[model samples]
Target chain A: MTSRSALLVLADGRFPAGGHAHSGGAEAAVRAGRVKDAAGLESFCRGRLHTTGLTSAALAAAAAYGLDPAALDAAADARTPSPALRAVARRLGRQLMRAARATWPSPRLDALAAMYPRGAHQPVVLGTTALAAGLDAEDAAYCVAYETVGGPATAVVRLLGLDPYQATAVLARLVPEMDQVAERAAAAARQGIDALPAASAPLLDLTAEQHAAWPVRLFAS
Target chain B: MDRVSLRATARIVADADGGLPLLVSDGPLALRRTRAAGPYTRVTVVGAMSAPLGGDRLAVETEVRDGARLLVDSAAATLALPGRSAEPAAYDVRITVGEEGVLRWLPEQLVSVQGSDLRMRTVVELAPTARLVLREEQILGRHGEPPGTLVTRLTVRRAGRPLLDQELAFGPGASGGWDGGAVLGGHRATGQLLVVEPGFAEKPVEPRLLGENGAVSPLAGPAALVSVVAPDALAVRRLLDAALAELAPF
Candidate 1:
């Protein structure tokens, strides 16, 4: 049986994967007055959960399912419209590769690192790392789906100085939808790469590009 | 279901003296080719319908031969209306550019009226040395009308390798996420311009906010994709014109 603790270890916010520097676009939303309180935060999380969250989860699941890593990486590149986000993904992936190699050594993981010395997409690396850790595709999907909201949630707390409990409550309220998105993502993995979801948030993409050009910003992107 | 299909191709041939470039095309798709001051052949649409109805299917195929340059444009905007059918209208476009060839496609705006649904897919294949400048514009609805459905997908490949693939879905009940402040931010008109060239350098261009609501950003690739969302079609056109002036080579 796969170790249940592996999921926890991977999902922990303090895994030291360099995800802390990114706000997942929450910083931009908060600055624009789109997300002020817990209520608006929940709405923002829900929107991201269905679009970018779902897309990332499916990519992780596909990687965990033992699909070709290079193909999955290409798909991830295609799905990401903003160059800024793409750079962030690769940076995170490189960081995750270091942690994963030390935590759970595997030939596949080593091969992936060698192939993409610059680093593959983060979700792809996360999925492959989950595979190396004796976990399944669904487990990897759950980790990614949760992080999709968790990253932004933490960012909002820092950016707007909102109540931590209220932000936690926003994530708690999204548990049901998150589970649904994770399940759909894992199922889509079995259907092949072409069948994967391409749902996109154009505003998020535009804002990401805009945010990258900013001379001053708290988060990387 | 009423369906419309168009197939068109453009090639460069030797002139009577075998000196200047002569543009030739075939197929039912309308073509009004004119020689510009430059080496590019300007092809404008003629005898085509102004709008598409429900269940309408359109297919346009174009090719630019080696050492040839072509530009495509339409006389007016393409307005999609709800037809008598139960499903949405469809448009499929395929384009191929040969070695050292250039193609510039700047179609007019596609406005979706109330109760209208339109699905469009464009696939482009290019040689390693080919150059392309393509633009797409969309208006959700007529002023004061409810928004309709529009799903657009673009895939570009060079030497059999994918360079860019993007899909956008907008309309009612499609995905509220797209309408969120972080996404489209409640804008009605949107435009995209893609420029792909060999040995191109990344330009440090910031996303500029046009008028009250429009903004443009340059994406990554040998291609630079500029997207803008505005309050209206005229505003979007102005934003696109400015962006194209900065990004487009020809």
Candidate 2:
């Protein structure tokens, strides 16, 4: 049996990955006045958790299920509409690959790094890393689903100066939905890549594109 | 379960004297060539029934052979009406372009009336040297009526490799709504234009936010995908045309 701690190690906020630079669209949302305080942050996170968050969880789960890495990468590229978001995904993937290789020391991980020297998509790398760590698809899904909201919650605390306690409470309230999303994602991963969810948030896509053009910004994307 | 299946192919055949290109098509879908002042052949949708009702299935398949240049246009906008059966309406479009082939498809807007449920899928396969310029616009509902449900999926591939894949769902509450959480963000009309070709370059274009909201971004294959959202169809069209002008010669 795979130790559950493996998931903790991968999902840790300070996993030495490049996630800190990204606000997960929180920067954009904050600039547009969509996320002013803790309540608005919850609404934003909920919208994201159901849409892009669910999509990422399913992709990670499928990767952990041992699907073809190249195909999953292509699907990831297809599902993401914004070029700016894609660039961030690849950059983070490259960073995660470096950390995963040192921590897990798996041949598959090495091969994937060599295949995509520039970088693979982040969720693809995360899922494969979970596989390398001997975790199941649901574990991988939970890790990504949590990070999807966690990263943004931390960013909101910095961007809006919201109370850290309030932000933590927001995440606490979302735990049940996050678990449901992860469960559905793992279930879909078993079916096939075609069955994966294509839920998209157009406002996020548009705002991300707009954010990329900004001259100065706190977060990368 | 009856469907209005339509299939058509456009190929350039060498003339007896090998001088001018001849365009030929065979299917229920009509093809009327226009004397447009351009290097490409302009074909208008003349005879085919364009509107689709609930539970109605419609398909249009087109192929452009090597060295052929075809431009397709619709005479009027397509209105998706409420289904007669329990299931929603469905439309599928498949297009293929051969080597050195160029295709430009500019169809009119698709309006989804209230209580209507429509699913539309479009797939485009292109050869290595082929180029495609496609445009699609959708309106939520008629004047002063709540919008219906619309699910659209578009996939583009070159040489068996995926270039662009996008799926959008719009309408009531969770899938979409006028609230800030909705995909449309309270916009009633939305449009997208895709330009794909070899050695495509990204150009700098100013954002169009005066009358409508829009953005243009480069895709993985060096192509460009432009999206525009407006309060009405006219605004969306104006914004789309402005964006397309910046990335023209597709």
Candidate 3:
């Protein structure tokens, strides 16, 4: 039986997926003075959710809906223009695969891991994990959409030492928008890969590249 | 505004006469073969009249045959103005580079004026040994005015494999938060430089930042992309020019 609680577990911050090391460009944004407080963080997350967040959620939903993983990997690469971001996705994918395999054993995950031993895109692996957990495409999309902002929110707490409750409140306010974005993503996935959203965050792409070159940065990207 | 469907074609092929490139032009896009001091054929795009108004379907196709080296540029910036009909203007550019061919597509900036809407698509296909240096810049609006809606997509394929495919949107009707702190950050001018050299396959480029607003990163293939968001066109050009000099020198 498909359990809805699996979505909660997958979306949880303590999923052991190596996501704690990354800030999804929040580190760069914070250092650049674009994000200095809760309001700034909210604005930044909202921007990311609609652009890269929507694109990623759709990719994950498509993979969960049984689209070809290889093709989706190529599409993800095309959508991600920054080489640094690409490396981060692959690394996070490898880490997520390791954790998901142990949590929910499946031959599909094994096949994907074998096909891309180094790693695939994180969203593709995430969708495969959702499939293994007997979850639907919307579930996968929800997980990605939430994580898209959650990663930054948590990182900003540590980076800026802002109030944790305030950070959580920022995420709480985005809950409705995240649901709308997830629904849009699931619908977009049904339309096929070509119809997927190509929304881009150029500043995120630029800042992520700069973050990767930083030797003293706390986040991986 | 007059709504018209126009298609223009340009072709370049290297001949036995000292490897000089052949040139062709058609319709509103007048192609003039100009003399250059370097070992390359230079073609200038002189606009026959104001074009790319809304509700217009326009296309410019250019091909570089094997063993040819071509450089293409425009005389002035292309302005997208509003049309009477609500239909958005479409501008399509198709470029092909054959084996051992080199193409430098350095057109002037494209400015989206107030109340105009445009959708532009640029597709490039390159052989395995071909080299390309392409630059694209977009100005959101005229001075002190908010921009109209504009969307652009660039797709490049090398040797039957996808190298890069990206789409950017701005102004009204685009997805929300495009001008927010995480996307354009209210920057009016944005541009990128793409350099595809087969030699990079052996020694890939190292990712780095260009000043405060630009970044250069290597693609999955033998190419490098430099993206910048700045306050104006001149600032955008400065970073792109620096990146071009570092990535692809004459």
Error of 2 at A157 (Å): 3.1
Binned by DockQ into CAPRI classes (incorrect, acceptable, medium, high), candidate 3 is medium
DockQ of all predictions against the true structure, Cα-based: 0.44, 0.38, 0.66
TM-score of chain B of each: 0.82, 0.82, 0.92
- For candidate 3, the TM-score is 0.91
Model 3, B139-163: lDDT tens per residue? 9998988998999989888997778
Stretches of candidate 1 off by over 4 Å are A1-4, B1-37, B46-50, B201-220
Candidate 2, residue A173: Cα displacement in angstroms equals: 5.2
At residue B108, what lDDT does model 2 achieve?
A: 87
Q: How many backbone clashes does candidate 3 have?
A: 0
DockQ of 1: 0.44
User: Deviation in angstroms for A153 in model 2?
Assistant: 2.9
- As a whole number from 0 to 100, the lDDT of residue A123 in candidate 3 is 96
Cα lDDT tens digits for candidate 1, A1-221: 67889899989988988888999999888887878888777878877877888889999999999999898888888778677788889999999999999999999999999999998999999999999999999999999999999999999999989999999998999999899989999999989887677666766776776677679999999
Between candidates 1 and 3, the lDDT winner: 3
lDDT for each residue of candidate 2 in B6-47, tens digit (9 for 90 to 100): 334433332222223554544434556666537676767654
lDDT of 2: 0.78
